[model samples]
Target: MVLVPLLRGCVQLLTLPIHVLAFLGVWDPLCKTTFPYFMSRFARLYNQKLHKEKQQLFSNLADFAGASEPLSLLEIGAGSGANFQFYPPGCRITCTDPNPNFEQYLLKSEAESKHLHFEDFLVASGENLHQVADSSVDVVVATLVLCSVSNVQAVLKEVLRVLRPGGAFYFLEHVAGDRSSWIYFWQQIYDPTWKYIGDGCSLVKETWKDLEHAKFSKLNLQHINAPFNWTPTRPHIIGYAVK
Candidate 1:
C-alpha cells in the first residue's frame, strides 16, 4: 500500500521535465521530430523479437485478397513501416500516421520490402480516415496503436467503415495486465508519465474490452506475452477481426 504512492511520486518527479516542456508548447513538435527517428531505430529490434508471432498473424493475409486481386492494406499508425516485411507478396499498402516525420523512414522500409507494393503515405489519424474511401480496403492493420488513440471506439468504427465486407482487421497491441499483478499496479503508477514520454501511449488500456464490443462479425483475439524486456509492454493481445 505504502509503496504504490511512493512509486507514483517517483514517476511524476522523473517526468516533471516532460510536463514542463508540454506546458511551454515545445513538446508536440519536438516529439514529432524525434520520435520517428527513435522508432526507426527501435523498430528493427522490436520486429526481430516479435518475428514469429507477426508471421503467424500475417500468414493468412494473402488469402484475404483472393488469387486474382492484389491485397489492399491500410495500416493505422504505421510508424516506420515496421510490419512491411511481414505482409504477403503483392500487397498494395496505404500507410497512415499522424506524424509526417515518418514518411522518410517509411519510404526506406518500402524500398526494402520489394515483395509488397507501396501506395500512398497519408498524414491522418485512425479516428478520422477521411482521405481513405469507405469499404475500399481488403485489410486494415493496427499494431500497438489502440493504447494511444484518444478514442479507441472511434478508431474501431473508422476501421469498420473503411474495410470492405468480409475484409479483416489485424491487430497486435500491448495491454494492461491482470489487476492483481504487481505489473498492473506499476502500470497504473507509470501510465501518466508514460503517455507523455511514449507519445500518448497508455500502459493500462484494457483494449481487448473495446475490441469485444466493436461489432466485428468475427473476432479471433487472444492474449500473450510479447518478447519485450519492458514489463508494461509485455502483456499483449494479437489476432484479427473480420467485418
Candidate 2:
C-alpha cells in the first residue's frame, strides 16, 4: 500500500515538467483571468515572509532619496499592489501593471485602507511607461520585476527618464549565477521548466552587468542569499541606484 502511494507521488513529480511545458508557448491561462486572483491569494500567504524584505528595501530607498512622507512614488510592474501595503504613510502612490485583473484586488485593498491611498492603476509596462511624466517621480521601485520584462535596457531608459534628478531606483532581483558547474548544469536543465510555470522569469539574466551598462548615476550593487525553505539556489543580487 505504501509502495503504491510512493510510486504515485514519484509519477506526479515526473509529469510536472510536461504540464509546465504545455503552458510555455501558450499565454498563461492564469494571466487571462485567474492571474490577479492567484496573485492576491499568494501575496497574502507569502507577504509575511516577503514583505519584511520589501520594507527594508523601501527604507533604504527613502534614506537614499532623502525624502519623507507624501513623496511621489511610481512602482512599475506593481502586480496586485503588494507594495502599497508596505509603503510609508502620507504618500501618493501610483501602481501599474499590464494586467487589468489586478485592479479589483488592488483598488479594493486601497479603498479599505486609511493610510495607503493609491493615486491610480493603469495598464502599463516597464519598457514603456506612457502616462508617467518625465523627471516627475521622486523614487522608482522595481522589486523582482526585471527578469520577466521583454526589454530590460528600454525599461532602464524609461526608468531613468521618469525619475527626477538625484532620485533613487531600488531593486530586489535574482540574477544568473557565476560559473559554478553544478549550479549551471541544473539551471540549464530546469530553467525552461521554471520560466514556463513562473511567468517569464529568467535564471540567466546578468542583472548586475545590465545595470552597469545602463550607466545609472551612483550605482551600488549588493548580493544577499535569499532565504530558501526549499532547495538551495543562486543568491539574489539586490541593487540600489540613483538617476
Candidate 3:
C-alpha cells in the first residue's frame, strides 16, 4: 500500500530540463519544445482514476453548454491540451498560458481533437486574462491552474468577468492540507523549492476558500482524496460552478 512519492509523480517533476532551465533563466526554447511534449504523456498517466471521473465531468460540461449554436471555452492553463479528449463535439477552445512556448503543442492537440477546434491561444497568465473579452465565453475551465497563480482571487474575478451569465466555471485542483499533520510541516518546508522547479505550483494553496468566496450562484463541488493518495498535499476539489 505504498504510494509513490510526490517528487516521482508525473506532474511534480514536469521535465528535468524545464526546471533546470527555469532556474537558469535560459530554457524557454528548450521548454517550449520538450516540456510540453513530456507534459502530455505524464498528465494522462497521472490522471488514470479507478473510475471515469473526468469523463463524467466533461459529460456534464457538454450537457450544460454543448447544445448551443456556438459554445466556447476558455481554459486558464491549457498545458499541452490534455483536456482535448474530454471536450464534447463542437466546443471551440481558447487556451491561455503565460508561456507562449506551448503554442505548437496546443495546436497539435487541437488537430488531434478533430471535434473541438481552437479559437485562439493567448500568451497570458491566469490572474490577468485581459486578452479575453468580458462576458464572452460560455464556459471557463481551470484544471490545475489556481494552485500556481500568485493571486487566486484575481484569477477568479477574471474568470467570472469573462464568463457569460449562467456560464459555468469548471475546475480540478489540489490544495493545502490539515494544519496538525506532519504533511503540513513538509509542505511548508518544501513549498518554496517546489514552486521554483515545479512551474510555480504552490503545494499548500487554500484554493477551496477562494472558490467559496466567488460569486457563483451554483456549485457542485466534491472532494477527491482517494485518487491522490500519493501525496500529503493531495486534497483535491473538483466540479462545476455556475455564474
Writing each residue's lDDT as its tens digit, candidate 2 over 6-95 gives 654555477675565464844465544766787677666556766667676677544533344567788887777666666677667788
TM-score, prediction 3: 0.83
Candidate 3's residue-wise lDDT over 1-243, tens digit each? 123345445444555655666678875455445666676676776567523767777777765564465678999989888888888888888999887777877788888898877888899998899989998888998887788888999999999999988899998887777777666666766675577545678988878889899899998888776365666556778889999
Per-model TM-score versus the true fold: 0.96, 0.81, 0.83
- The alpha-carbon lDDT assigned to residue 222 of candidate 1 equals 95
Q: Arrange candidates, best TM-score first.
A: 1, 3, 2
RMSD of each: 1.4, 5.9, 5.5
Distance from true position, residue 149, model 2, in Å? 0.8
Clashes of each: 0, 0, 0
* Model with the higher lDDT, candidate 1 or 2: 1
Best-fitting candidate, measured by TM-score?
1
TM-score between candidate 1 and the true structure: 0.96
Show model 2 residue runs off by greater than 4 Å: 1-30, 63-69, 229-234
lDDT of 3 at 196: 58
